[model samples]
Target: MNFLIRTNWWKWLTMFLLTYTVVGGLLFTVPRLPILNETIRNLHFHVPMWFGMIILFAFSVFHSVKYLSSKDLVQDLFSKELINVGVLFGILGIITGMIWANFTWGEPWSNDPKQNAAAVALLIYFAYMILRGSLSDDHQKARISAIYNIFAFAVLIPLLFILPRLTDSLHPGSGGNPGFNAYDLDSNLRLVFYPAVVGWTFLGSWIAGIMIRVSLYQFKKDSE
Candidate 1:
């Protein structure tokens, strides 16, 4: 974690991959499927946003657990900032998904089970942020926020993965819908899709790292 905060290589790699994804995802040939046709290009951007969000949230929960055991304020800072960035990615994912849905599903929103579940999951995390802001003391805020972050993540997994699958969903891979794996047989898409995930995740981390550094500095300054 500390090393990533100061590293340059991964950041450079992120820029390169993102540039490639944007360029290739737009120009590259995609599988021509019924109804999907060209909108399948969204696969590069939309899916990666959620992938990055999940990764960021998982890291947030890990740091939340670390803060619980170690009682380190810095760990608490990491957890908080990670959620901040994770929520940002989640919102972007929703927006991009909506755009794709409008093109493919004939509407921006169809009350899809997974979409509702995702909205609920994000609200839970938003509540976590609100809960933190309502507190005054740093220690109390950190402790309570850490616990809430863990709980939010616990609820998040079920909301996103379990509840959505129990019913039908418009999203791929759930509710009797065949996943992209069925249509994305074109190796060309994978060439950019996989890197897009890594690139977006790294970009999120870079943003969170900046936030963490600023917050940490403020935290230390306020202590003195």
Candidate 2:
């Protein structure tokens, strides 16, 4: 009973928050500007995906660290599951961002620094997966994969943040638009934006949790 209740509570919250985000984001009052126009609503959808990806990847790294410390296969499984969901979120983020860019930026694949960095970051993690596939031994795979996870995350942080800031980019808080943050999002957008992040992250986590459980079950069954 307790287990069911605990699991259902966050699931309910994820649904509620996302429902509110979708409806409110489209219909709710937003600041009107020249370039952004109605597309500012993408904040509720597109941006959260990146946020969710970061959150999911952070958890993946956490589990990776744990795996290194304890050498537990379960930890490795959790880390892998998180990366899987993180990549899904990254793909969603990139697709949605391209759609948004086409309307506002006049080009879907403009050479935006931030976008380039994001693509590179995903590539880095994909490489980690490839590295895992190459190693059949579980112990070697776990240890090496965890190390790569940590390194990829370390590089990812700077690639997303520092590198973008150093170059001219269209993303907020970067490039020639030093004052972009001031004009980027107002309080009204934030009301939905913060919850959107939480909701999306929670939902990503829920999806990862489901994947982890199913995989673990399959592993157990195979073992038995």
Best by TM-score: 1
> What TM value does model 2 have?
0.93
lDDT tens digits by residue: candidate 2, 146-184: 999999999899888678878777764564444337446
**Tens-digit per-residue lDDT, 109-152, candidate 1:** 89999789878878998899899999998889999999888887
Span of ten consecutive residues with least summed lDDT in model 1: 175-184
- TM-score for each model: 0.96, 0.93
What TM-score would candidate 1 get against the native? Answer: 0.96
Per lDDT, the best of the predicted structures is: 1
Off by over 4 Å in 1: 175-180
